[model samples]
Target: MSIKITGTGSYIPNVITKNADFHQHEFYNIDGSTFPGDNESTIQKFKAITGIKERRYLDDNLNTSEMAIIAAQKAIEASGIDPETLDYIIVAHNYGDVKFNCHQSDTVPSMATRVKHHLRIKNPSCVGYDVLFGCPGWIEGLIQAQAFIRAGMAKKCLVIGAEALSRVVDKHDRDSMIFSDGAGAAVLESSEEKGGILAHESATYAYNEANYIYFGKSNNAEAPQDLRYIKMNGRKIYEFALVNVPKAMKSCLEKSGKSIKDLKKIFIHQANEKMDDAIIKRFYNLHGLDVPEYVTPMTIQELGNSSVATVPTLLDLVINGEIENQELKDGDVMIFASVGAGMNINAVVYQY
Candidate 1:
């Protein structure tokens, strides 16, 4: 049995904050720095950096788990599966659900239970677990879900990669401007064959280390700080992706007995258009493959990175037909890859 993402779902706050709105003078600093950003008129350089028009956000009021539950419920609905029947609940996070003292995130063990309760998942015996990683969380979760089902450890699972990036945004930081609160989830079940997460390969590089590449820390369980906001040596992280992603992709394909040529599409993590191009160029040189013309580069220009939820949101767009007329077919191979601050890269091969 293989694990297939039978159902896909996502949640972005209905609010549609635009890059133009960020241009308002209020967002400008007295020093002339503007977190709100520059108008499209002045910037002729990176004109079409990201085609994303807008992104969703959650008020400062909510936690990652709350957003996660919302997204998971949608997935559950789409699959028409009973929450109680879910055998495993895995949440990939860079932050906790709540303060350890009063919140569940600090002690991630409680995350699955809380999610079930939030979404009214049935029964009281489902096991809850958590996985921690940076932007690579989604792909990692997909691969793990397949393993669990294949092992018969789970019959049905709820996998989520929700991120509340807006809560941590530093209004004065241009880098943070791209961030927004968001959530994405999928209810996976045991598939006899055909669809879902078909193959996966991933590894970490302990030797190459840098700053701005670690998770937050919490002093105490009640009010955790350990898994706070994202950190990374942006420059180094990009370089790492350029080298590491290609390597990971090749290994994943080899282990699965497939190649890029066999894939109908490649769903790479949407970090930035520049990064996308860098990886695209790398792909051409190594495997002689170019990202299919119909591939979706969903990263938002002003919408900051949303970590784990990135790929799934793109997947949701595809299933919902938001991806538009494209060249993907029912049995095409699609690869999802991610390289994050941890100096870790994950690559998964899927039959979509």
Candidate 2:
């Protein structure tokens, strides 16, 4: 038996927030000092580094769970699976549902429970839960589902990655531009067919890198210390990822017993353009090969970094042919990798 993603779906928010929209906002440094230069120059620099021109925001009337539900519905439809037959529902997220204009996160019910409730699956045996593994959460969830299947604990599982990062961002900080809102989901099941998930690697480096990406007070010094927003030391994260992510990917591929030449595509987390490019380059260098064109697909230019949602959302887009010049075929070997808070890193070697 093999574990495979039977279907995939994603929900891209409708509200478009362009870089030009931030021109009138006051930007500040971590110490509350005014940002150097004008908004135009700042935005240009941001674009040059991150390659983000715009991002999507969840509608004011909806929350992260709702987005997950929508994506889940599409995935279920695509899989032609009965909701009542699902053995597990795993939702990966960071901040729970943060309503528009609200500071508190609603996690009492748990995002997975919320999705199961909304999906209206009535089977009491359909276990549901949540994971908080930073941006790599979805890929981690996939690994978990595969483990469950391998252990004969489940037959079918629904995995989702959803986030409303826009609601948790400190608008006063320039880094805020990197975040947005979105959700993606997939149905994983045990099948007789071959070419499924072959191997995976996961690690957490919290000793000295624990605070690279964190929730901290706003950049504006006057902002309430009691209220915190998503924050990160970009330089630290870039350096850390460059050193570790490629190693993880190489290890995963090696464990799968697949050669570097077998890799058809890499669905990496859309954190930053330059950082991702460098990681891919380094990964190829380790294999004594040049990076192949179109090997790494990205959605960061239009979707920004939606916390845990990036990898799954990008996968859903490519699987559905929404991303141009990218396509997957039978017998194709691919790698899914990501790095984020927890200073966590993970990679999955999959075959389709």
Best-matching candidate per TM-score: 2
For candidate 2, lDDT tens digit of each residue in 97-152?
Answer: 99999999999899999999988889999999999999999999999999999999
| Candidate 1 per-residue lDDT over residues 48-115, each given as its tens digit | 54444455676656677887888898898899887888888888767655432232235434555678
Error of 1 at 164 (Å): 0.9
Error of 2 at 300 (Å): 0.5
- lDDT of the candidates, in the order given: 0.68, 0.95
In model 1, which runs have C-alpha deviations exceeding 4 angstroms?
Answer: 24-53, 97-109, 215-229, 297-304, 326-328
TM-scores of all models? 0.82, 0.99
Number of the predicted model whose lDDT against the real structure is largest? 2
lDDT of candidate 2 at residue 104, scale 0 to 100: 98
Error of 2 at 132 (Å): 0.3
* Model 2 / residue 241 / CA error / Å: 0.1
Model 2 TM-score, 2 decimals? 0.99
